[model samples]
Target: MSGHLDAVLARVDAGLEQSLERLYALLRIKSISTDSAYKAECQRAADWIVGELKGIGFAAEAHATPGHPVVWAKGAAQEGPHVLFYAHYDVQPVDPLNLWRSDPFEPTLATDAHGRKIIVARGASDDKGQMMTFIEACRAWQAVTGSLPVTVSLMLEGEEESGGKNLPPFMEAHKTELGAADIALVCDTDMWNRQTPSITTMLRGMVGEEIEITCADKDLHSGMFGNAARNPNQLLAEIIASLRAPDGRVTLPGFYDDVAEVSPEIKAQWQGLGFDEAAYMAQAGLSIPAGEADRSVLEMLWARPTCEINGMIGGYTGDGFKTVIPAKASAKISFRLVSGMVPEKIRDAFRKHVEAMIPADCSVRFTSHGGAPAITVPSDGTYLQQALRGLSDEWGTPAVITGSGGSIPVAGDFKRILGLDTLLIGFAQIDDAIHSPNEKYDLDSYHRGIRSWVRILAALAV
Candidate 1:
């Protein structure tokens, strides 16, 4: 197995430049799915990927959705377990063009201040560059073994940057075809750091709610009814302030009931990672960690649940101050949920808490955007061990299992809808600046990323 892997990896090394050329080609297309002006470009990107997959011996095609087209491909069935790979083809819009050092659509290879070679472009690291690593790996494996070690399927989306509404319906319509795989591989996360490779084992979920608190039927003048009239703005501020206690814990009833405590083993592993809380604070221009008591910044971010006010708009203030008391105030609240906490339950608790705080004359209405429960993959699985070993061999460092604070809805969807666990692995670094101006993917990340996938595929084949 080791000798065969070595041969395939060598093939990957020999063809690294060609792999990069292919990535550069994909990065050049302006497949910004959010804007209709780029709709044709999105289709062009999908078509390009379909042709590439076919050339690599996969039966591939593009299927049109209500929005952008989805690209799916399948290689010839092999002896090992089947795996489904997921990535997005669409890139984010490159606004504030003046901030960019070069044209975002033009892929440029340049060195950073630290002397790291980087490919600069929109969507370079977000998914385009990362996804190409998997494809290039498959290309190398086919060149060496004339086939992939395992049966493989590719599902590329065009609306990941936008809201992916078509994906759930499409997956529902083709559940059997996609769910046949033993596991799903998602190349959409960052490595722990520049040198250490990491696998995301847990992803936080989300619950978005918009609450509108209504007081008077119309705006009231403060001079006319300063002390007598009920002010929804004040009421809203009070309700929002009551969400957390002085100790920085959520005050919602049963919010902590289902949230499980971090295990001693996992906590110890995270502690050993040498996480610099002070430095992390400095980057955000802060010196204090404000969250649940006694928890480290990492634990607060990854392991614990959180309630945040995403947006609040009620009264008026434009150019000058308006002394009128607004009739209603509204706020958009989002909850970052952890495993073992149900989204609906959290939503209900939040609504209950808000209703309890409303005065007799005031009325509160809640609007739910959406909610998804958290997902956690078992660390002891055979496939996980294979991936960890493969990554360790490629990077010469033990792969760290980490939890992500941000939620990838598709990861949870795979488990809930298809009964399949997903392995989230990627070569992106923290400073990739995805979705921001001057986005980039390290050249080393692109090269070693392909090699790592090669090793993982060889191991999974066993």
Candidate 2:
């Protein structure tokens, strides 16, 4: 098994340029799913993926959705655990185009000051480059052994950057077909660093709300209604300010009812990861910790729930001063939830808190945006051990189990709909600048990522 795996990895190493050429071919397509003008481009990307999969002998299709088409594929049946690999082909919109060094749609390579070769493009280091790692790995295995080590399926979503509006229903509609997988693989996250590999074991959930407050029939001049008029802006500010306590704890009623403390074992593992608080703060231009005062930075980020005011609008001050008491004020608030926290319950509690704070003369309306519960995959399992062993063998370093502060809704969807646990393994670094201008993926990451997946597949075959 080791000799065969070595031969496959050697093939991956020797064919690295060909693998990159294929990835570049897909990245050159302007598959910006959010823009209507690029709908045809998205279709072209899907069609390209279908063609590639078919060439590799997989049963593949480009299925249409209301928003964008999803590319689905499956390899021949094999005597091992069935795995569903999920990734997105769609890249983010490239606004502020002038800020980019090169055309985002045109894939290019340049050496960084540190002498590392980086691939610069819109979807580089994002799902497109990441997804190719898995595909190229499968291709190498097929080229070497004539078949995949395990039964494999691919679900390449086209709407991930645009809120994935069509994915849930698509998954529900195809539940029976997708649920046959024993586990899943996701490659849309970052590694620990250039030298270290990490697997995301926990992901925080999310809930968003937009609230509008109306106090009067129309905007009022502060001169005429200086003391008499009820200012919605002032009231909204108060409501927002009252949401948190001096200790940085959310004051909403029952907000902490389901919140759980970080386990000691997990905390120990996180502490061993050498997380640099100063460096993290410097990245965001902050000097002090902003969350719960007593919690460590990692705990605050990965384990604790948080309430943030994403945006607020009320008064009028475009260019000059306008002393107008706006009749309406609105704010967008988002909550990062953790394990054991319920989404609907937290949303209801927040709404109740706001309603209770509103004055009788003022009316408040709430708009729900999105909500999802936190996801935590067990740290120890057959698939997890296999992945760990494989990754350690490939990187020559132990794979760290880490937690992600952000949410990946598809991971939770797989658990809820397909009853499959997902192993998140990727080669991108934290400085990939995904969804930002000048996004890049290290050439070494792309090369080694394919080899890592090959090792993982061989380990799983055992």
Candidate 3:
């Protein structure tokens, strides 16, 4: 019954140091879920989250999954919407350690080249720091009013960075408890820039596959078979080349059959964002625009579907030339699906296209890795408008609705499994170098992130 907005904001400001200490404790744990050696560490992270939730007066516990433990918690029941908050505890593997200035597990506060203080760690900006924003906000509200403003349930995942294959089934098993929510909040994405706050509404989905082609029983000497033997490597190369047209369209049959055009209103809003195409390409050491020829960089990323060859393997030369035609060749491919595309249909079309390309004498095998559909939040929803107002209030700048090119599988899973719409409200920046060495989360982002959620919670309360 009490709305302690000002007092809650003050509590967040006063308790910033303590919040950092808690986040540092989490950042210190080596909870990389992809590797087998760090399985115990992942469990430790999950347990620590449960403990934190319980300390804050939530009925919280860790549930064992086939892969890693999932931390589930519920707050005091309230009158407003029952919202489910989703975040991941496990981080990406910190490889190429030499590229880092300090230990990846050691959380350090240092000033960046732009003179902003940053928290440097493995999971600083990806999900750990981002997720902690929500937890810390809850703590502040609970301290100020002795209760949260709305009904809250949290589902923290540990296998997000490692493909998160177990989460769909896990959600299926706990749908009654998890699916009772009115909406979902995911804090694992990025803001539009340093000065702006963003709520992501569009998330692209994915379909991953691997194909192998065989033209002979064994590797043949290039000199012996240079003119006679059919080379699988050559065949695979041609197929790969045929995938994309010179005009940057995929050749897969029916690939565009289900694709939908973005509304003109949305397109105008994106164009008004003042996106710096030059800077965007310069970040990746590229100067030319690739992909769809007639689309803007933002359009190519957020709206258009894409087919990319991730990897190709055929022959090898360790120290010198081997001059051998490999009997087999394989390629790893992935498709980023937009709103209207179906995963199975796209995969089937790709397979049929590949099959049509194969010669009668050669055989090909298809291996499917995983698939999920894209998610699009309604642009004119009431809850979305309220959250945007809250963010604008906290930042003193207008908040924007944005879309992401990358796939957060859990967002799609939340939609498909639990039948819930999610607000991908994140406080991370684009250049946080997440999933790479020397990752960092800005102090300003962390401090303002908590305040942003504080305002959002207040605005969402009935």
Candidate 4:
């Protein structure tokens, strides 16, 4: 290890207890963004983060949004590349609180079956703990070297758990303030495995639409006008059925017109990882590949575009049964898009398809929820190399570049609004129970995460 990194690691080791205490203090705040009752706590959490950043010698402040506040901070300016760090201070609601062995807000240190020490709390692994890894690293640097090696801007949001409606506008308003960075470091993703470090390279985009079809002016009794009146539910089902073929491919014309095929190099790398398709299916209580017949599970999840019906409602779905031909039927649909596919184009094509299917007796109305396109960062960037090398130096294994199945909308916003690429790195594990009952962060992950950032900073400085 380099001498500078060794010094930073030493400082982190010396301050490990203090770091845990700070994390415990933040975890105690019930900053649940989805619940209006926790609004004050969210502000308190933002204030606490601001204080922590200020305490570490950064110029920090808590900026209010329409909902919760976002903590913005910056370290001393440097000549090298600047990195904008992003994470969330808010956590998911701790419902079914009876399931926890301890208070969700009162964090405790416990040992797991494998003898790994863990931090048990509400936001232990989701984000609070993960974000602290970077903060603690900065603290270590400030302690040992008296300043950060490279410049950093920290942006912690309190509305991530509530769909980040305020983040885009906030970014738009502060484009000049937030746009002075080459890349972003987002600590909201997970590693591929317990011992393996990963850098996420691709994220799927999302598009949502609500379609309502009206066939009759009013509901008619089945016994009275069942044969004469057309049922909108039947029409809705027919239209939905026509969207996909028996071969599992979407039937919409020009839907896959812009989708790019997965590169052979990526295919080979994914194959070498030896992903277990059966194991993944077993976890979800299934036995079949429900997507494209020829693609592997990894390809289907990481690279393919898909259409799914999120919800549908037509007739009465209440207590009993109503024998009536419903006047209107509605369905909510979403598409997961890959590279080269535009959300607006997909929305236009879908509207066209539905319009062509509508009969003379039926009328249709479409409501479009906004969407963002998919993004794939170059895997061979210098910052990525530095991060991978740093992680390898700390963990004795080269980091793997993987693709995330879910969308991080803020990432797209960063690229679109600010023209910044993001480096998604975090220490959360799959079984950490994020957004579920009994959330916990492994103590080992916390310790090594600080150490990892120490090395990453050193690498980036070089």
Candidate 5:
């Protein structure tokens, strides 16, 4: 093992140029899944991945999906704590493209204001660059030691930017091949800070619902109806308003029934990180807390369940004002739930709340989108400890455990379908501009990321 580790490190140091070239080739594919015009580009990216994996002596293929293809690969001798590595080949659409300093598809190396060298491209840091970190690490191992420290199955989906509809079915069909993993390695999260590595301990769940309220057969003239007819717009607004109180507590009965309070130890850990609430608000051009009265800003974001009105439409929204109450009013609402809160229960409670708020003259219709429950990994897991020790050894800092406010549905799916716990470790930072204009990945991040994964693999294999 010591000799193999030495050989892998030597290979990584020698393959730096080849690694960057491969990343550049991948960045040139323009695999934007959300855009129909880029369908072929998505396939091209998948094909490229297949070639890369096969070049590394893995049996790889690009399997067709309804929208895009998923690149699947497996190394030889699949035994001994096999790991399923998950990543996405698809990148977000580069709209508002003019904001970028260079073409989003044209990868470039540049230095940032902080003197950190970075890779500028559409999917540079989001998944492509991050995924390559692990892949390149494995490549180094295979090139030097002739095999990876552990058996690995690589699954790179081309539709993560869109909903991963094809993934669940694919996993079901290939359960024997994909489900043999003892654990999953997910490279989709960020470090706590530029210098501080983070292992994401929790991820908030999500529930989305679209509600439509109808009060009349057709649009009613305000002057003609006056107070005679009911207005669905008013009813819908009132119902939404009633969901949350002025103090930011959700007003639905039993809404907090299953919510677990933040532990004092965890709270102290978060406090010690020295999060600047005022600075965070200032960046968003605000000055007041919009969450529960007693909770800190960090707690509000990472621990609390929130009711948010994603979108709403009613009456006339065109150029001219129309003095008529529309027959129907519709809204798209969502909830970010923490651990212990079931999405089904929340959806049911929301439906009940809307129904109870509706007048006899009005009718309410609810449509629920799919949802997943929150997840929290035990901090003391063996894999997590290995990750912490590896990252600390590589970066010279203690790794932090943090929770993200957003949902990563695939993480939940991995736990449900494969019964595999995922370790969320990556080198992306908070200001990487992922899913936004001018996305980038720091060059130092890309280089050190490879080294970090090397150390992690070595630790895990031990």
Candidate 6:
């Protein structure tokens, strides 16, 4: 097996330029899903991926959706474990276009200040570059051995940047076929650093709620109804203030009931990651850590639940003061949940907390955006252990297990609908600038990411 993998790595090294040309071809499509003008471009990008998969001997096709099309494919059946791989073809809109140094759709290579070669283009690091790494690896494997080590199925989405509302239903529609895989792989996350590879083993889930508080049926003059009529703005502000404690804990009843502590070994690993909280804060123009008083920054981010106020709106003075008590106020709030917390329970607890604070003359309404439970991959799983070793072998550095602070709805969907946990391993660095102007993917990242996947596929060939 080692000798076979060596041949695949050699094939990847020899075909590096050809692989990049393929990536450039896909990147050149203006597949911006958010903008209705680029709808055809998204379809074109999906077809391109399906064509590339066909070239690599995979049975691939582009399927229709209400939004952009999804490209689904499957390789020849193999004796190794079956794995489902996921990525997105749609890129974010290029707003403030002047900020980009070059055409967002025209991929090019440039030397960065760090003297490293980088590929500059929209969707380069966000996913086009990352997605190609996996495909190129499979291409190399097929070029060398004429077959994949694992039974591979791919779900290349076209609406990830545009909220990905169609993906869950798509997966649900193809549940048995897509869920037959023993595990899933996603190439949409980042490495811990350029040299240190990391697999995101956990992701925080979320629930969004918008609350509107109505105090009076209509606006009242402050002079005539002063101290007589209720003010929803003040009432909303007070309720928001009461949601958290001075020590940075959410005050919702039972909020902490399902929260679990990070294992000792996991906590030790995070401590060893040497994350600089001061530098993290300085990047945001802040001077202090603001989460749980007793927790480390990583712990607060990866292991704890949080209640955040996203936006608020109330009485307004367009040009000058209105001198009136507003009839209603509204705010959008979200809760970041951990492994054991249920989204519905948290929503209920929050509504209960807010309703308890309403005055006799006031009324409140709650609007649920959506919610998903947190996802955690077992640390002791065989596939995870094998992939970690494979990554370490390719990078010459031990891969670390990390956690994401944000939710990935697709991962939740996979777990919810397919009963398969996902291994999110990607080679993009933090400074890749995935969704911003001048987005790039390190040349070395692209080249070695292919090699890493080759090794992982070989290792998983049980």
Per-residue lDDT for 1-462 in model 6, tens only? 557988889999999988899999999999999999999899999988888899989999999989999899999998869999999999998777999999989998999998999999999999989999999999998998899988999999999999999888899899989989999999999999988999999999999999999988988898998898888989999999999999998899999999888999998899889899899889889988886899988899998999999999998758977898999999999999999999999999999999999998789999999999999999999999999999999999899999999998899999999999999999999898878999999999999999999999989995
- The runs of at least 3 residues in candidate 6 whose Cα sits more than 4 Å from the true structure, single-residue gaps closed, are none
The stretch of ten residues in a row with the least summed lDDT in candidate 2 is 1-10
Model 5 lDDT-worst window of ten: 1-10
Model 5 gets an lDDT of 0.88
Worst 10 residues of 1 by lDDT: 1-10
lDDT of each: 0.93, 0.92, 0.92, 0.91, 0.88, 0.93
Q: Write the per-residue lDDT of candidate 4 for residues 80-125, one digit (tens) a residue.
A: 8899999999999998988898999999999888888999999999
> lDDT: which is higher, 1 or 3?
1
Q: Give the TM-score comparing model 6 with the true structure, all chains together.
A: 0.98
Model 2 residue runs over 4 Å out of place are: 1-3
Clash pairs, candidate 1, are none
TM-score of each: 0.98, 0.98, 0.97, 0.97, 0.96, 0.98
Model 1: residues with Cα > 4 Å off, grouped in runs: none
Minimal lDDT window, size 10, model 4: 1-10
Backbone clashes counted, model 3: 0
| lDDT of model 1, residue 103 | 94
- What does candidate 2's lDDT look like per residue over 54-155, in tens digits? 988899999999999988899999997999999999999999899999999899999888898999999998889999999999999999988999999999
Q: How far is candidate 2 from the true structure (C-alpha RMSD, Å)?
A: 1.1
lDDT of 1 by residue, 1-462 (tens): 445788889998888888888998999999999999999999999999999999999999899899999999999998879999999999899998999999999999999999989999998999999999999999988888789988999999999999888988888889999999999999999999888999998899999999999999999999998889999999999999999999899999999999999899999999989999999999999999998888899999888999999999988868889899899999999999999999999999999999998999889999999998888888889898899998999999999999999999999889988999999999999899999999999999999999999999988988
